[model samples]
Target: MKDSSHPQATPPHPAEDVLDHLGYRLKRAHAALRGAMDQALREHGLTVPQYACLEVLAARPGLSNAELARATFVTRQSMNVVLRGLQDAGLLTRPATVEAGRARPASLTDEGRRRLNAAQGAVYAIEARMIETIPGERLSRLLEELDGMARALKD
Candidate 1:
């Protein structure tokens, strides 16, 4: 017989418990990575969001702000803020589009491209240092699991 009135009478959930533990660890790891990357970028006058905007613009020149928002999984308003900061820094340019009446094409300047390229090594180093263990197979599996979770959540 079980005592339902007892606070400890509940059965432990294997799935939820594992997810909670993993989520906490993942958050902590992400915070640490973000902190290190932010510190590294500070000297260059860049934040994580700003760096991401530069990278995306460098990779896909002439992207509209809306398209950038979609690609970056950010709101258009939020991306506009990033664009403004980058533009103010002379790292990015948004020229009025000749093809469209009101659409502006976002592109990175030479300086922006150079900075993005320079940051790549630091980004790679951070990722490598963080995921140095757990083997390649496990890392791949973890990535797959995360992708699956993303897909499921999106639906």
Candidate 2:
């Protein structure tokens, strides 16, 4: 017979509880940040997704839709819609394919570059406002942790 006084039990962990709890708070924080970005971009006639695409193209020119999708962490179909929208806006261009039966690779147009440049200050302002209260070291740690988490998740 088992002793009633001694019971098998799991260890207590407030850390595990707060892990998901803090995650929920982080999601809300991200939504707030995204909303601010969306509003700032809207003033310049761009959505957050479109701005992300523009930033990706600006950094790495001549990306195919597949590569762009990968960079944006979006599905190919969603990227196709983004590409079509940007193309329609004359903010991006796709060169005629050099290889047989291949689609043209995409790049940002001069106008797109100029617009992105113009919006740079506002974007920085939004980011700054969000992190302004945070200490530099704390912000650095937060960024490192977030990037590490993202890499882990990707893997």
Candidate 3:
């Protein structure tokens, strides 16, 4: 009963073609990016979380564990573990007790800055490679679209 002469008539997309899904593509891209960053950061003796913490601390100077967890899109417990490891490595410092509130603010040690500086080059290089894949004119639009997608899901 269907008109075969109609040009718009097409078969339904197969469910197995996950690559055609926007979420699947986004997830795949994120996984690839994470893997690349992890490999690059490993050479600097830093994990992704460690690098993120240091990067945030370097910019903000002092941030509570909860603040960091939110910023890094991780759980507070995971951030605490990362803080502990970084502290043990002498890359960051936080007082054992807080005077005003329960939150112990964290900051990077001098060594942390040095290490972050060393790692930045490799990280930037990786970013550059990613950016190179997209056209320069479309970069801003792509970023805005990505942000829009995130906001749409978040709300």
Candidate 4:
């Protein structure tokens, strides 16, 4: 038998209490963030995919539908629906006919830019609130750690 002089350090988030696995915690965090974004984006008249598409297009104009679908982590079929809705809403534009390749590229309209800029305030606020939960100095380290975790799972 070993001496019980030194006790184990309790984790900040104790195991099985929060389902304390890193992946499960990550999923939980993602779910919460998604829920918050969905509510905020709804007020801006955008679905999450539409907002994501607008954000991506604003940064990189004229991305093909296939490229967009990949960038947004959605299926091409789902992105087709998003593109159609955005087009119908006059938030984005695409050629009526395909360009060189099978997929037509997309660009945001003026209205799209206006809406995205408005929605960004809410989105950034939500992110800022999340960041406030951790120490300011840890913010960059947290981001790097999150990226590291993602890279570790890429295989």
Specify the highest-TM-score model's number: 3
Q: What is the lDDT of residue 14 in candidate 3?
A: 50
Q: Could you list the CA RMSD of all candidates, in the order they appear?
A: 4.1, 5.2, 5.7, 6.3
**Model 4 CA lDDT for position 107:** 93
Worst 10 residues of 4 by lDDT: 9-18
Q: TM-score rank, highest first?
A: 3, 4, 2, 1
lDDT of 2: 0.84
Better of 1 and 4 by lDDT: 4
State, as a TM-score between 0 and 1, how close model 4 is to the true structure: 0.86
lDDT of each: 0.81, 0.84, 0.91, 0.92
State the lDDT of candidate 3 residue by residue for 60-133, as single tens digits.
Answer: 97899999999998899999999999999999999999889899999999999999999999989989999999
In candidate 2 the C-alpha lDDT for residue 148 amounts to 91
The local lDDT score (0 to 100) that residue 108 gets in candidate 1 is: 90
Off by over 4 Å in 3: 1-16
Q: 1-155 in candidate 1: lDDT tens per residue?
A: 87878866443434556446656767887789889999878766788888888888878888888888888778999989989888888898887446647668888988888888888778778889878976877998989998997798798
For model 3, the local distance difference test gives: 0.91
Clashes of each: 0, 0, 0, 0
Error of 3 at 31 (Å): 1.0
Evaluate residue 69 in candidate 3 and report its C-alpha lDDT on the 0 to 100 scale: 94
Q: Return whichever of 1 and 3 wins on lDDT.
A: 3
**lDDT tens digits, residue span 21-53, model 2:** 656768988888889988888889988778888
User: Residue 39 deviation, candidate 1, in Å?
Assistant: 1.1
